[model samples]
Target: MGIKSFQGARKHQQAGEEIPLKVSDYMTTKLITFKPDQSVEEVIDSLINNKISGGPVVNDKNELVGIISEGDCIKHISDSRYYNMPMDDDRIENRMVKNVETIDGNMNIFDAANKFLNEKRRRFPIVEAGKLVGQISQKDILKATMKLKSQNWKK
Candidate 1:
């Protein structure tokens, strides 16, 4: 006199390998870069045309040397008027931030997001062997999050 089982047999779920999300996978490979000798006016034009806040400055070897932003361009314009110097005379080398911070391409997306939050930076350049490879922005992190919305977040 055993009780009858009404429910069907439970299906066994297979454990699948989870892939680690890396910054390089979500970073932008093609970038709008600037040269040290380029004029601030030209940088400003590129920034406006591209609708970007800033860009990286590289050397002849494509090595990251600095970063130039809208703030720098504005400062150059202000300084030009104050010093009575022509805006055309200003160079990216003088206006760009020389001591630039970069991030690794293999870093986890969560770690990269944390870095962006801690550093208060909109984007971080990815470098390998002293050469600029790509860049990851906050928007890219957001896109990654959206893409992984169904997956569990792991460290």
Candidate 2:
């Protein structure tokens, strides 16, 4: 006689039934945004107060214009010392990265992770209808992974 199996039959998941993990689900919606006219000194203050590396720069209409980070502020400070110029005179528009790359909210976390690795970026802004909706960081991806630790990752 064949040996009897003790374990119950495994359940198969239906196609498209399991919801994919998306970037929007883990992105931070309430962001500490900056303006182009703001001073580098102010940006430094906000970064320190919030304990963040950088923030998105937006216009009066809440449109993403650029991004400013600690690195940018540091460069501004260095230039100020070299040029013998006051630090307060420098504006974010001068130091901010105008060409910003954004990520789609609907993208799966795995694809987002690969993009992050390829881009070497700490965070990416999520835009909808040309408006800054949220931002996702490496830490957020880590959090998502931890949340799904018990589940198997789909290929």
Candidate 3:
């Protein structure tokens, strides 16, 4: 789904009391991704350039291998400084979360929101057929919930 779909969903939801919203309706389809073999410096640059906290680590085939976040990157800074090595020496594969928790695009938004609350994660990679497709973030959930609340108020 795209931005238009999200708007449609929002409008439809506003017109009714209950309209089921799925992750696909709110998840971001455009993504900035990383590769496992990529240098930490490059990853950091990409993340910063994209104005994102992190991104999914995908293989050449676009398969989800891991996830990298600011938290993971922060944990390596001291070590790199102590070792007197460039951040480029660190590979994202070594720093990324290998056992990443992923969500399906068709998943219920409420379910995804619960996962965000319980896991305390900022974002989740949307996996379909073992490939990274999109992402959903805590901010996205917050926006969606706020929209829902506003729609409720219109009734």
What C-alpha lDDT do the candidate models reach, one value each? 0.91, 0.92, 0.84
Tens digit of lDDT per residue, candidate 2, span 14-125? 7776644999999999999999999999999999999999999999989999999999999998999999999988889999999999999998998999999999999999
Pairs that collide in candidate 2 are none
Best by lDDT: 2
Q: Please, what are the lDDT tens digits per residue for candidate 3 over residues 25-144?
A: 889888888999998888878878889999999999999999998878877887888888787788999999999888888887888989988999999989888888899999888777
Provide the lDDT at 143 for model 2. 94
Ranking by TM-score: 2, 1, 3
How many clashes in each structure? 0, 0, 0
Cα deviation of 89, candidate 1, in Å: 0.5
113, model 1: CA deviation in Å?
0.8
- Candidate 3 has its poorest 10 consecutive residues by lDDT at 7-16
In model 2, which runs have C-alpha deviations exceeding 4 angstroms? 1-20
Show the colliding residue pairs in model 1. none
Q: TM-score of predicted model 3?
A: 0.81
Give per-residue CA lDDT, model 1, range 60-154, as digits (tens).
Answer: 99999999999999999999999999999878999999999998999999999999999999889999999999999999999999887656554
Q: Report RMSD (Å) for each prediction in the order shown.
A: 6.5, 4.5, 8.6
